[model samples]
Target: MTVKRHDGRKADEIRPMTAKVGVVPNADGSAMFSFGKTVAIAAVYGPRHLHPQFMQNPSTGILRVNYDLLSFSVAERKKPGPSRRSKEISKVTEWALAPAVNLEEFPNTVVDVEIYILQADASTRVAGINAAAMALAHAGIPMKTLVSAVAAGKLDKELIVDVDKEEEDFREGEGATDFPAAKLSGRDEFSLLQLDGKIQPELVPKALEMISSACEKVYEVQKKALKDFIENPEGGNGK
Candidate 1:
């Protein structure tokens, strides 16, 4: 069965994307990123002193991430405080971004990344991760490379890139699944890989390949956003 996306994109195509840096003046670095209707804003603070109690490694900086979904971010209003799912997402996001950052350079300090989802469709975490990466770069944090992420899944027996909310519903349930993957730009190593729902073991490799190519495209958009912000800090469009 042939499956067509409502947005008119090809199976391998990603959604329309836009990103901008320096969204929050008070934050050391900030970015607003959107993939179609899903929007996420990320703020980076610190590389500053960490309290004595929380300092786990005296020789390396600590990276912390907080992921939040606004009460009105979805069709049904979400709760105000962090839920268990949010906490897990925060942990994975932190890990996903840590590989790109030079944490050892600022020992006894912390780099805090906060990501807020103002709107959601699907692939919200991926959007948030991409935003957080841009925010870190904006803050002048040393890094190996920026991170880019994308979600791909099997829908109606066909592989699709950047799943939207409707496709994610998977009501028909024909081997549907959500595979979210993230990797450092220009690198083959994966920083995050998550699978939800069912997919044949044989297809896993193909799914990873699709997602990797999608991330490379996302990486180009991320680079453009950072470049634009650096060249036009005062006239940035993120606000």
Candidate 2:
């Protein structure tokens, strides 16, 4: 039998999400976001001096974002050292957030964004991106647009959005033949593919459609949260 999500959410439904800004006292700006069971915290530091001097771009400030996955958050015990997975995630987070930030305004300076995964149900990368974006805004960093991220996957022969661990397991077996197992294979369509299974090339359009819609819904939550923080700066609690 196929495992269903708790809310009976459709395949395209993104988990309920909330964003709060300025959660840290020491960082210049910070934000925390919860998407279903996955939680991520991001802190923005910088425009600070660079080391060795040579690393500085000279024309524009650098945007550095660190993403850490806490061992306690996941079910399995994780090794302390950084993983190739984390490195890949860090690169993607930086790319997704850099375009939104106006680095040119602070030439020779650097803005560092840190993302910590407090909980990992699923979709941690998307959560990290959301948290980082909120933290940057709370820090008063100028941005062109708010970046959004989400994952789409195939399950039980159907394409789904925001697949949790339970749903994922349903499709992982030799008996799992009926589902859309081969609808889309390569993940080139998505900015980041978190799914372990494959789908066919023809189904790429459908997957993009699902992911985009989910992102817009999430984007609203982020905008509202940042707006609330702006109206009540003290409420932000970011030092």
Candidate 3:
């Protein structure tokens, strides 16, 4: 059976996307990223000194992340403060991005990444991580490579890449799976792997391959966005 996405995207196609850097003038580095209806803005601040209490290692810089969903971002207004879900996402985002950064470059300082979701359809975490990675590059933080992410899911017995909100809802039903993964660009190492639903063991390999290909595409966009920003600091559309 052929499954048609509501947005008209093919099973293997990602949503229409765009990424822009230097969106927040006050931040050391900032980026606005969008994937279809989901939009995430990220700001990076500091390679500055971390307070003694927050400093965990004396020889390496700390990578701190705060992921927030604005109250008006969803269909129903969300609460103002950080929820348990947001906190967990923040921690995972930090961990996912740390592997791509050279934390030792800043010694005892901290690089803080803050992501705000202005809108959401699905795959908000992936979008947020992408924005954060770009923001880090925009801020001139030393990094091994940009980190890119994508979510692949099983819907109607067919595997799909970059699932939107409607497909995500479908995955919540029986026998469906929503797998979100992230990896550093040009490397086989995975930085994040999360499975939201059950999947046949045999399907894992196929799903990983699908998401990895999607992440590579996203990485290309991220690189272009950062390059445009660097070349045209005054104004660049990030085409």
Local accuracy by lDDT, each model: 0.90, 0.74, 0.88
Q: After superposition, how far is residue 66 of candidate 2 from its true place, in Å?
A: 1.1
Ranking, TM-score, top scorer first: 1, 3, 2
Per-candidate count of clashing residue pairs (backbone under 3 Å)? 0, 9, 0
> Using Cα atoms with residue i matched to residue i, what is each candidate's TM-score against the true structure?
0.96, 0.86, 0.94
Tens-digit lDDT string for candidate 1 (104-152): 9888889999999999998999999999999999999999999999999
Clashing pairs in 3: none
Residues 35-117 of candidate 3: C-alpha lDDT, one tens digit per residue = 89999999999897787665657788899999999999999999999999999999999989999999786788889999999
> Model 2, 1-239: lDDT tens per residue?
44355569876787888889879978888989987899999999887887658889889999987887998988997776679988878887787777677888788888988999998987788788888888888788887677777766676467777756566566444212112111111222233444455667687677777777777777788888888887887876746
Which one is best on lDDT?
1
Deviation in Å, model 3, residue 180 alpha carbon: 1.2
How large an RMSD does model 3 have? 2.2
Q: Candidate 1: misplaced stretches above 4 Å?
A: 173-175, 237-239
